[model samples]
Target: MYHYTAIQWIFFFYFYCFFGWCFESTYVSLKSRKLVNRGFCRGPFLPLYGSGAIMMLVVSMPFQDNLVLVYIAGCIGATVLEYVTGVTMEALFKVRYWDYSKNKFNFQGHICLGSSLAWGGLTILMTEFIHKPIEHLVLSIPDSILTPVTLVLTALIGADFALSFKAALDLRDVLE
Candidate 1:
């Protein structure tokens, strides 16, 4: 199993969050014909992507040599994460961010087999081909540069969360 420093994991979390936001925003914009954040966070971060990526990384570490197992497990794990995220967001904010109602083999419009496989397949490719080099690059950064950058990002994310949470609460109250 691969073990990463806490700092490295932090780096991965933030990187994946922003990356997810970019991908999601672009895809949603293409579909809706307008720009959209496509993220739960007010900032350019997707917590779900952060969670999913790190979850798969840690989960796949144990099966480093077993590509097939990693693929299967990553798919199932991500799918479950997606479903839970959808349900939790709705339950908490009285909103559903995305619906898979029209997708085949979807459960409660939360998760579909097609998307699950796509996520899993992507996980496999990332874990096998991309993560190691990225991890190496992340680790190579001197602490002098890495620490301050990480600190700034954490502060910004915290501020965004606080403001967004307050707004969500106000909106929820209004809806109620």
Candidate 2:
């Protein structure tokens, strides 16, 4: 059976969250110019890394041996989540949060294959390779100490997301 330590699972959660934020920022930096010209606005919300990770976990539950499949699933799932979040946010805010659905690789308002692949690859690389090892390293610590630290880190991540969301709201002035 595929078993993971508590630390391992925690790392996966943080790792995916970090990747989501990174992907959103990276996409904005590299693609925003083009996206803007095309009439789409890059919303400030973090990309759906958590949702992707959750989806990946569920998919991987049934197929533990196939890492490749898991990675692929994570990438695709994350991309879809990101798109859905964007669409929902736009509807809630009455703004063009983003509009990749019309782009060449976009289908019905989501990113194209190119963007999706890039985000997915990065997420896999970070979560499977980088994050896993780091998690293991942290796990080697005594649990009594590690548990509290992990909780602190998770709280910090949540706070950071809140701040970023506020910043995104501020950016609305520019987008409008």
Candidate 3:
């Protein structure tokens, strides 16, 4: 198993959240032919991706040596996370942030075979390639600096999440 301090894990999560936001925002903006701030939050972060990355790392620990097992674990783990998050968000907000209702082999418009397969591939790529350099960079940082930065980020993200949650609720009321 990989050993990481709590701060290190938090940093990894935040980093992945930012990265996911960059990717999603760019893709969405390109698709829509306009700039789009994509995510549940107004900030440059996506908690789902952070959570998914962490889950991928944790679930692939035992199967790290085997590519096939790693892929399988990622498929199952990420799919479950996506499904749960989608269901919970829709239930609480009365809106779906994403839907796969038209996709083949979809379940309840929340999860689908294509996404599960993509998650498996992404897990393999992240574990095998993307995370090594990131891990090194994070490890190289001094704890004194990293700790304070993490604390600040935590506060900012907390505030952003609160505001976003309120906005989502307000939108739900409007829709109702």
lDDT (Cα, tens digit) per residue for candidate 1, span 1-176: 77776777888899989888998999999999999888767999998888988988977777878888898889888988899989998888887878999999999999998999998788898798877788888989988888889889989998998888788778878998
Candidate 3, residues 64-119: lDDT per residue as tens digits? 89999999999999999999999999998999999999999999999999999999
The clash number for model 3 is 0
State in Å the error of residue 8, model 2: 5.0
Tell how far residue 85 is off in model 3, in angstroms.
0.5
Give the poorly placed runs of model 2, Cα more than 4 Å off.
5-8, 19-47, 50-58, 94-102, 117-128, 160-176
Q: Worst lDDT window (10 residues) for model 3?
A: 1-10
Tens-digit lDDT track for model 2 on 1-176?
33667665775566566556666667766776543211122322233555566555655555456667656766677677777777777754456656776567676665677777775566556556655565566557787876777788767766766665566566665676
- Residue 39 local lDDT, model 2: 13
Q: What is the TM-score of each candidate against the true structure?
A: 0.92, 0.58, 0.98
Tell me the deviation in Å of residue 110 in model 2: 2.4
> What lDDT score goes with residue 128 in model 2?
63
Error of 3 at 167 (Å): 1.1
The local distance difference test score of model 1 is: 0.86
Taking all chains together, the TM-score of candidate 3 against the true structure is: 0.98
Candidate of highest TM-score: 3
Give the least accurate 10-residue stretch of model 1, judged by summed lDDT: 1-10
